[model samples]
Target: MSRTSVPPRRARTALLAAGALVLAGLGAVSVMQSPASAAGLQCSVGYSVNDWGGGFTANVSVTNAGTTAIDGWALTYAYSGNQTLTSGWSANWTQSGKNVTVTNLDWNKTLAPGGSTSFGGNFNYSGTNTAPTAFAVNGTPCNGGTSTGSPTPTPTDSTSPSPSPSTSTPPATGDLVDNPYVGAGVYVDPEWSAKAAAEPSGTKISNQPTAVWLDRIAAINGANGSMGLRAHLDEAVKQAAGKPLVVQLVIYDLPGRDCSALASNGELGPTDIDRYEHEYIDPIATILSDPAYKDLRIVNTIEPDSLPNLVTNVSPRPTATPACDVMKANGNYVTGVGYALAHLGGVGNVYNYLDAGHHGWIGWDDNFAPTAQLMHQAATTSGATVDDVQGVIANTANYGATTEPYFTIDDTVNGTSVRQSKWVDWNRYVDEQTYAQAFRTAMVTAGFNSSVGALIDTSRNGWGGANRPTGPAAKTTLDGYVDGSRTDRRFHLGNWCNQSGAGIGERPKAAPAVGIDAYVWVKPPGQSDGASSAIANDEGKGFDRMCDPTYTGNVRNGNSMSGALPNAPLAGHWFSAQFQELLKNAYPAL
Candidate 1:
């Protein structure tokens, strides 16, 4: 990536607008380099670059050489050549002319003596790429040294989290707990935080933890240049800092993935089951099982929009797609997801939460029971069982509100049921929380353990702003009542792209309600669902009409306006305007 290159985007990462939970691993490259720093706030910085002619990827490993624990540090270096930064991970990256600033993320900020943490970035240049002559940490000039027998650099997940531990959270050791996040620090992605902090009001929510989407195989290793599955996990352990830490990884990328949509299409073909299992899921599972991460609580959001598509996007349904039909006939989604669940679930520290469709997609009577059955089928097949699954996640990367304060499905106006309203559209549920709770109950009935939990993705569903409804909509008409009383502002319930006026939903919290393990921002705000129009790229993503604001109705959206914002980038790429709007309208306002 060059200085002028756009940032990588993957908000819901692999949910909705296109992909869901994916994982990858970036192999380390050994390079000859001099390290710096020996005491005080000093650090030894190792810079390793993987160049490809016009562009190059660089890894910077910072080893704390100080006697006392070096907590909260910033690394700085000057590029000897014209190296423009495009994107980065493992830390926050920023450049001003030739100088680059790398700040430790919440996870990597604390470096005990003799310990090392790493971050990397992508750069573009025309001439020779010369490594910087000097580097510094926390304003102290770094001295030359090499990572050697450092006891503190790579500590287990038992390390205390940096920047002050919260007194409210219960402390934890290296074992499983009822709710991993109950007294733990969730990972704040340095990559996404860098993007957020770049915005005018980005700092408001930049540090909030969001799921790191490893959508494609390439992403598993590194997207934009740094942070593969191993890199992310390694950072998570560091962030754990002797306390329980939760690292959310989206386990997306099934063969013939997202059959019902084009924007988040994956690299695997419809029948690439073997590749999905061996190359993708198996490798991720192996990485997660690495003994180093045994102390971290790893939460994997199983394939989203996969099983539900099998339930609702197949034959007989007017919303069905030929691709969906092919997917169903092939039976890959079920197998792939089942295999993923089986393998990842084997990891000691991993907790698996399958993705259930949002309230709008599977809340209907005809779709509910069947979808739950489909989920049950997956959970029990391919060596997986109910015990392998901790729970299910709902409305992932979707704009479904957690709740509707003004009305219920049972409410009536002039003898017309709320389900009769255009917005409710015959669906049995009014909002995500109700849908999730009922779905949880149905899951138990469908054979999941009674203790199974549910996760609600509250990112971008708040719909708060001046336009937010003050109370139930006018009951003069059923349609008006449903429309006015709702918190979700989408033109249609099926609108899943970069919807206009969408705002950040509930800030993530654990055990927010009964049966609900957490309210999460699985879909990080400010990332585009898909391209606004057809654009070409190698990322395997296609342009779906749903992402084009000007495109007219799709069966999924009830033929309404697409409800997307304009000029969106491909799915997972940063959407500046959308981020700005998210801040402008954040609920419990920023």
Candidate 2:
């Protein structure tokens, strides 16, 4: 339920030039038609981007300046560089070399004069990513010149922004359109890849990207004999091959980390906040800010299970532990986390996503709002503002379905609300996606930017296999229906170790859901969450009973039997059995 990891391309937009358009930094670079030319075309386009080295997401608003409704439109433009189209929303996008064309979707064909509609696409490129110089609307060879006020004009009564909010997929964050994952490839760790590939039929997901956990200070320089931070970045550079790529790093190792659980305790003690800031965070920041690795989009999943503990695992909550109480009293959790956010966030190419505990932990209304406030507090203190943090991540290193397709929180059976069911426990969310999206609103309400997005760790949350429910359960007792229909099959909602029946979740992908930046495999699938039995190591992980299959319940897990698999290795170590189980039970099935 807590503790784990965290982990744009602009391939999306070419506002064809025929009129005035808004390009954020370019300052009112509009797409305008000459007055003396054919009266057939008179409109404006707004182009904005979130670029990370080799790719970008282009968002454009095309406005009809003519008095009459301009029906059936297509916007055309040519990229000055070798930009290739990746994916787009609200338009039928096509590209040939530098020339790109975006035709309005059937739902968006009518461009009412004085009204504006927007569409965007993701793109990949090499060398300079120069803006397009020419644009034509609907076969009119019109001259596009600059004349614009704010980039986005107010939509008039007739302007239908194609792709209704209800009917179409939500788009990426525009204010921070420079999302690093949009058109970039994720950095695939050779270490994890080799282990996965060694398994039977493992090649299917071995090549996928996963985050590297720098759980200890030694990990920064390469713990044991593994790859160091710079070494990984160096390899990421090679893998980038002239295009933008992302390297995911978990900035863990805070003083008294994972206070509620024993499994992920860290090297620092409760009051060792100074060492955490200078020794751990500062060193990593120094390396990431180096210009050599600036081209790689470095994503830091700023300490999971840190600030959230101050809310759910401290005084007043039944789940509170003595360790959590100690850390809260000292206030070092906030200090360490705030320091990490400020230093790591200072790197221009780096995007820091603070970890929000999964829905199971904070979905209750009482816990939800306060958790967001704590996150904002951590972000603002220690020289960090909300802007310093890009967004948040949920279900890190934990199993929470990206969605529960079979049912929703609103479901009821025999006049009983699903929230009343024991499985739901009156919690507001039924799955990670709902909780994450709603938490995004909460974060903004708590004063983070409206542009702040969310990331869901889909690494082991798929919950698919033969036991996976095909549809909603038959109408019966509310508990029966909710339990039978749920995609997450945990014996109890609170279980959070190397759970049996867990499968690899959605493959790592970019800009997946509304308010979500990406679905990532931050906790590599095969890595054990903790030792099944008491084991000792120098990395600072402990053996929590939650990882013991034979152990009985805890207050956090409703006193149920621990559902973890037996004989698992230490946390963060590879467990072949776990990996194979994930492969076999994969939801979209391997």
Best of the candidates, lDDT: 2
TM-score of each: 0.72, 0.71
Q: Model 2: residues >4 Å from true position, as ranges?
A: 1-177
- Residues 300-377 of candidate 1 have per-residue lDDT tens digits of 899989999998988898888999999999888888878887667766667889999899999999889888899999
Model 1 TM-score is 0.72
User: Deviation in angstroms for 167 in model 1?
Assistant: 38
lDDT tens per residue, model 2, 479-590: 8899889999999889999999989899988887777789999999899999999897888888899999999988889999989999999999999999988998887777
Candidate 1 at residue 121, lDDT? Answer: 74
Report every candidate's CA lDDT: 0.76, 0.77
Q: Quote model 2's TM-score.
A: 0.71
Error of 2 at 182 (Å): 0.7
